[model samples]
Target: MLKKELPLKHIKINYDPIIDTPLEIIAQYPDLYEQKIAENGIDTIIYDNDISDNVSFYNITYALNKDCMMFMNLPLEVARFSISNMTDYIIQLLEKSYYVQFLCDPYWVSNYVSYQKEHHEHPMLIYGFDTVNKYFLAQDYFDYKQKTKQLVSFKDIDASYYNSSFSQLPDEYQLLNACVLHCSKIVNTKAKEINCDLIKQSLINFLNCYSYTKVETEGIYYGIQFFDILINRYHNDSDYVSL
Candidate 1:
């Protein structure tokens, strides 16, 4: 197959581990995300993985709920290509200039350098692949290291794919927890350059939708009011009073 590729888009916000995968995938389409944010006054957040158990991200931050257009946490099927064998499907996505994110075991994908049979689920954005050469070009982000884009062998990818803990649990070769985003739907949103004002407003919006009752019992505090409380306490401390 002819090589298909797209430029990677770097994320702009302070990264949060809970939502990093979806943000990185969305970052690949900056124009679309920006346009939506400008016009709709919100980001169209979508998730394929069930993050309901992530109480902080889902309930407090509203990352998965606010401005959500659509979300499904079920297995996805493509009519043209089998999810079990994504080579053809991925190539087609590349041909159409779509970013394809795949879930794989880090151990096999990195040739066991990252770990030994750890089966940790990781997301990789595949941009281009050469069928004749039997390799694919992809990018990955790690918290402790700089982001990287590298070419990996098809055999290694296949091994990681089939060996993913998500797939092995069912004893079948499948794309586990696969999610694809279509941002074109909200592409017409007004584009506003990110600034301090926008950041403040986004925080306000987040606090408005979040229910204090749910997290208040858990001792999770946030927002400007909480900040004031912290500031007052700091000022009252004997250490600061002497200073």
Candidate 2:
């Protein structure tokens, strides 16, 4: 049996729960984390909102390319496609240096709050594999237990991932996200430096009330402007305002 391990760290992003798992997972990579803090750190923020009144994020998404690796989120069925055995697929990914994220049924996962109690679906991140022990190193946030790094048996992961309900979940709820921290040896001998000029321009863009056009659709708000939107929404449509 082979064993492979990667960084599995999570930091609390108090501003937005929507991106907590993904962004915190991103923080585990050294180069990405430092660059993220240098520019897209908390002080520079963007708030994204939809007509449904859902407020998703309160910080900027530099989309710093995930170190130019891969990140894809698709419905479970779409994700599985030719792949079989969820646990095996996950180990395949981990062996290739990719961290896997999927909506795991915590009820089947030991050390989980709902383990053996109730079925609740939430994003679970798996970053390492111990084939000899039949366990995967995972990170998950549970309300009652507090967030922790856990060792989950392959049996539990398989059961949690292959649960029947996950297939029936709505498009937004059914997701399997995988990301890799791309690696390559540096050519230059000098120490790395943050792009101060780019950071400056980003601030200017935020201050000038620029909206991110890369959004999937029009009318999605971004940047400092969302503060006004948040205030108005809270006053006018408090019932719909959600984080």
Candidate 3:
């Protein structure tokens, strides 16, 4: 008989001290970091300060699934710090059952947190992502949202490079193409297990077909997929999964 997929149990967290520690030193002892999370309830820790924006925190979140606790310091709003670099760290340290909470605003950076709370999903957030922006551009609907403005807007140089990089990904690996039929079933079933609309939408988004005809809908669809993949990978890893 095939082995059954187990529920998530814990999450692993990695922090980039250089980037996350803040120049002022948030905690006297490194252990204090973990202690704080414990005070709030969390598990596992790693430390780093350099990463890439192309990387996604959801990757780490999914990898941990519901098996472990994960934590990290809030990403800095300063331009000297790299979002991509921070993203890389987030992706590497994800775990299951662990919440990757940011000690930041809820409105701009709280979508992941909101999704988790609304869904009782595997990954949870203690804080939210930052929403302060240094670059100026024509304001759009997304710009009106602090979180979106912070998370999505990029420096012109970074934006061009990222667009090119995304364009080069294999069609199968493209955000929309990552899911196979089997993965879709796994996600849908898991969403029910979690009893969350956010999780359900996330699963649906990941498995959606990429269609040029529905560009606007596809964007929303892709966003869900992005987070779903992050949660799924973090939660479903062998180290976190028990037989």
Kindly give the number of clashing pairs for every candidate.
3, 0, 48
lDDT value for model 2: 0.45
Model 3 TM-score is 0.17
Cα miss at 1, model 1 (Å)? 4.5
Which candidate, 1 or 2, has the higher lDDT? 2
| Candidate achieving the largest lDDT | 2
Give the Cα RMSD of candidate 2: 13.9
Candidate 3 stretches greater than 4 Å from native: 1-84, 95-99, 110-243
Q: Rate the local accuracy (lDDT) of all candidates.
A: 0.42, 0.45, 0.25
**Candidate 1 per-residue C-alpha lDDT over 1-243 given as tens digits, one digit per residue, 9 for 90 to 100:** 467555543222222232333333222234433333222222222222255111112211211222221222112332221245656656656666555556556666653346454445556667778888877787665332655678877877676655544433232222222222221111112322224333345545654653333233244334544334333443344121100
Residues 1-243 of candidate 3 have per-residue lDDT tens digits of 111122332323222211221111212223432233223211112222244211121221211222122222222221122234433222222212122222221122223333212211111121112225422211112222232212322232132223233233354323211110000001212121222344445334433422223234322323244435435544455223210
Candidate 1 clashes between residue pairs 3 or more apart in a chain or in different chains = 38-190, 39-189, 39-190
Lowest lDDT block of 10, candidate 1:
180-189
Give the distance in Å from residue 181's predicted Cα in candidate 1 to where it truly belongs. Answer: 9.5
Give candidate 1 misplaced runs (Cα > 4 Å): 9-19, 23-82, 142-144, 167-243
- Please provide TM-scores, in order, for all candidate models, with all chains considered together: 0.47, 0.47, 0.17
